[model samples]
Target: MAKTTPATRSLAHAGIAFDVHVYVYDPGAERIGMQAAEALGEDPKRVLKTLMARVDGKPVCVILPSDREIAMKKLAAAFGGKSAEMMASADAERLTGYHVGGISPFGQRRPVPAAIEVMALGEPYVFINGGQRGLQIRLDPRAAAQLLGAVSAPLVA
Candidate 1:
């Protein structure tokens, strides 16, 4: 796996400290995030998943733990919208310029409103996609949230 990616470059440019971890990606896994957590031998709560969603028709990015599911209503409230739904995979790929299971909040094709689950922010460190499959970036969750301008909210169900 290449050590550099748009996600890593973005963090480097911002001077945010992070570490890269590579694992065998299981494309057939039922849940990509959980697969990643198990492969990395880390707690599911410390492995965050990036999700592309729409809030009242406007695009938004959401980050939450591998073990949790986002509450759509709470997602909408987080972004001050009345409704929310996950974006189509094709749309998410186009918007983020990343394949499914490899999207990263740090370096998207376009920047959108982003939110990080409040519970995740309390973790000492969290692993997020590194803009590529099989790659993960570990960093301080608070720093990650700040760098993404992500709102901290109770997004999980």
Candidate 2:
């Protein structure tokens, strides 16, 4: 077993079961999840990505497939907000207590409202950042929304 990340610890405490995956992390990889999909030899759709954003100026977490783009208006609407925008990388890091490429929806420094793109729900399991680069945690997608208090919505553009 590998050393537990904040993400892993959080999940364990929450009583969620998961499998950890590791791969060589290339420094300066622009799209970490896509790089993870390639390195793990998995479909890009199974690798989820976490994005931190502001819906009505309140920080929120958005989970979507690696290959998709977030639809800000739809995201805001799901949250009953007037607008939504991506948080700056620095803000994301500060709020999530992890680097931009490794921000997990679990174990955030502050618990914020979250949304999971509806498509991820159909996946039997999904890989999400495991609190650091080069690592991911595969788990049932519904756990993200059910246990993490995230609403599932059509949040991808």
Candidate 3:
């Protein structure tokens, strides 16, 4: 197992139980999320991809299934914002203190408002980035939402 990152440590500190999954990362892979899913031999639907966005000019997170696309309008509505747009990769990295492909919903330098894809809330378990490339954390979806303070919404289409 890899050394504990902020994401895992935060979950641990919160007394949350989860499984750590590490897999080889193919830098040449076309999509980071799909790469992780394939490498881990898991359904992409059960894996999540974290995205940074600006909602009404505030940093926010949108977590959704690897195979899904976020609906910007729904995301904005979820947070009671008039507008929401994906943040530039560089800006996202700067804001969350994690590189673009490694952003986790947990353990941000400054936590932000976040929303989860509605369907993810009901999954038995979900795998998400672990604050770095090649590491993933699997946990009960419900617990993750609570820990992330993520509101559930139809953010993905």
lDDT (CA) for every model shown? 0.96, 0.90, 0.90
- Shift of residue 122 alpha carbon in model 1, Å: 0.6
Give per-residue CA lDDT, model 2, range 1-157, as digits (tens). Answer: 3548889999999999899998887777888878889999999999999999999999999999998889999999989999999999998998889988778999889989989999999999999999988889999999867878889999988
lDDT tens digits, residue span 71-124, model 3: 888999999989989999988888888887788988988899989998988889
Error of 3 at 52 (Å): 0.2
Q: Whose TM-score is higher: candidate 1's or candidate 3's?
A: 1
lDDT of 2: 0.90
By TM-score, highest first, what's the ranking? 1, 3, 2
The window of 10 residues in a row where model 3 has the poorest summed lDDT is: 1-10
Best by TM-score: 1
TM-score of each: 0.99, 0.96, 0.96
Clashing pairs in 2: none
- Evaluation by lDDT, superior candidate among 1 and 3: 1
